[model samples]
Target chain A: MRPGHEEIKDKLPEYISTGNIPDDVKEHLRSCDKCSQEAFLLQELNKVQVPEPGGLFFETLPQKVRASVRQKKKGFLFRFVPVFTLIALVVVTGYIYHTITPPLTEEELFTDPFAIQVFDLSGLSEDDIPPISVDIADDEIYLTEETSLYREFASLSSEEMEDLYEALEIKNRNGGVL
Target chain B: MDVKQTRYAEDLRLIEKYLGGDEYAVEELVMKYQRKVYSLAYRMTGDIEDSKDVTQKTFLQVFANIRGFRKKSSFYTWLYRIAMNTCLNHLKKKGNDTLELNESIAGSNGNALPALIKEERSSFIRGSLKKLPDRQKTAVTLRAYEELSLKETAEVMKCSEGAVKAHYHNGMKRLKEILSASADSPGRKGEGI
Candidate 1:
């Protein structure tokens, strides 16, 4: 047996159809009845004609297929319309809500936690405001002590007056004796 | 790969489109293979209307089962396999269940006639071919009549390349025997294969 006969026999059908036999396969096919017989039959099969249909027989197939698909989609679209409408309604409602709603005021946005709203004083004149009172006597705080302290202490309580009288008496006595 | 080879890639792209719900892709798919499918059918069934029927069945199968097609082979290969099955079913339904040979005589290579005689010869060959085993007939029809490559024939036949070749070999051998036996004499009732 030739070294390549097995391969050739294995590939004989392809070799016969394509006429591109390997050299070893070719050598083997000459002596091999089985392989040669295959080659001959394959060759004859080549003579069979591929028949062509007359006119435009196949031209309408695309339309037919398209029509069928269209029918299916139309059925689907009936189901599709309600879902599509629902989605559209939701989206439109969301957009309206975002557009029509009022915005937050600056005060409401940036309010201070420690601050309170008070009446304005920038519009008031001095005469429109009351004076602030000081608890000190005028002579002491404004008169430079030239005024008599005895007159100011005349309304003092008994103990304080007594102490003031004593201090005054001591001062007078020390002045006269000295 | 040759010019015809590039069409496979294009077919894959269209199939992707078809799967993606482009109706146009369906139309395009039908447009691409309709004629070839019809022609293969016409040749296989030997009737124009029957060819149309099988072609319709073939594409219908493509439409229905396209989602399940794994892209393991090119779309045409799978389509033709479906076409081949449909054709075989048709032939089977028509009860051409065996190779009942009808002998047809011929003029040898030197004396073969032209025109009308050629048509006669072609018809005779087709007629005689029906007598082959179903598998051999399918292999030859795909490989020879359709001129599909062995690989494509294997895909269409849903068999290995080796198996396809074996079917082709047996078919070719049987075809030769039948043709030769018929060619032994013209205008005579031939023996059954």
Candidate 2:
């Protein structure tokens, strides 16, 4: 075989089919028995019969393809919808956690420091307490105010109180008040 | 219009319908290309059920991303690319050791097919095919058996034309060697499983 026989032999089928074979390559096929055999072998290999695929191979494929597409699309939104829902749920949970929680009471806020102050060691005696004056005149004004409702009520007789109560009860028993 | 032009137009119409919210158009597109997609996947993967899975996966991906298609290539070209990718990805996930078939897989049917001899030869060819490197195998299956043009194969492969040429060359060369060697070997029967 020639030095470049492999390259020419590789292209032999294509060139022969296209009818543009050069003379030098033709001479190579003629002179090199090995190259000739390779070309012949390729032709024979091409002739090796490949049978049509068994079953309704072609006819069933389209339905299978459609079913597959439908299957994918069926879950297209389902795939991401849950993720969004989870995110929203997390955010709402966090918000409610912050907003609905009660504020700390003053006692609760000062518990640590106030605990020390609450157990005071200091005790004061009653003798150390300051004296305070009573204003009896101010207290007397309530009794002396002649036109006040309190004074008038205080002046009411026991019999007058019973008569007033009886009149009020009579008005209450009347369902015609409206 | 010519058949080529008509196919393109029809593909465009279906795509428009799908984009306009007619999901049934996706079914139409599937009906149009499912056989081609499945056959390509089956040829590349060499497994009937696996190829069906790949075909289903490819169409799902297609409709999922169909709106992104810019009509730069024919719809079939785009569909073929998705189908090829799905098959190759499926192959990768199954791993490189998966290239060799296991015993349980071959006898899996327990002689389900009526024509045992023909099934055996078919299995032999598939086993030999898996021995090719993935890209080369893809190129050989698409071009030789699937009858895709070099351009279409390149498009499906998402590679330069020269790369397709090289892949097909190396692939065909290796296939010839493998086929010839298998033919000469008495032990070839076990290789199918």
The best candidate in terms of DockQ: 1
Error of 1 at A110 (Å): 60
Candidate 1 C-alpha lDDT tens digits along B1-193: 8755688888989989977878899888898889888877866777777888898778777877888989788888888899988998988898865654443322233122222223345666666666677788788777765657778888888789899888976666566655555544565323332
lDDT of 2 by residue, A1-178 (tens): 4437767854665654444667888788888865665455444434544446568766676677667667777789689999999999999999997789776566876875543323333586666555443455655645556657776777789999888778778878885351
Off by over 4 Å in 1: A1-44, A72-178, B1-5, B97-120, B185-193
**Candidate 2, residues B20-64: lDDT per residue as tens digits?**
877778778888877777777776777778887787788889988
Which residue runs does candidate 2 get wrong by more than 4 Å?
A1-61, A77-178, B98-122, B183-186, B189-193
The weakest ten consecutive residues by lDDT in model 1 chain A span A139-148
Taken over the whole model, the C-alpha lDDT of each candidate is 0.71, 0.69
The CAPRI class of candidate 2 is incorrect
> Global lDDT for candidate 2?
0.69
Is model 1 an incorrect, acceptable, medium or high docking prediction? Answer: incorrect
Q: What is the TM-score of each candidate against the true structure?
A: 0.57, 0.56
Ten-residue region with minimum lDDT total, candidate 2 chain B: B106-115
lDDT of 1 at B186: 60
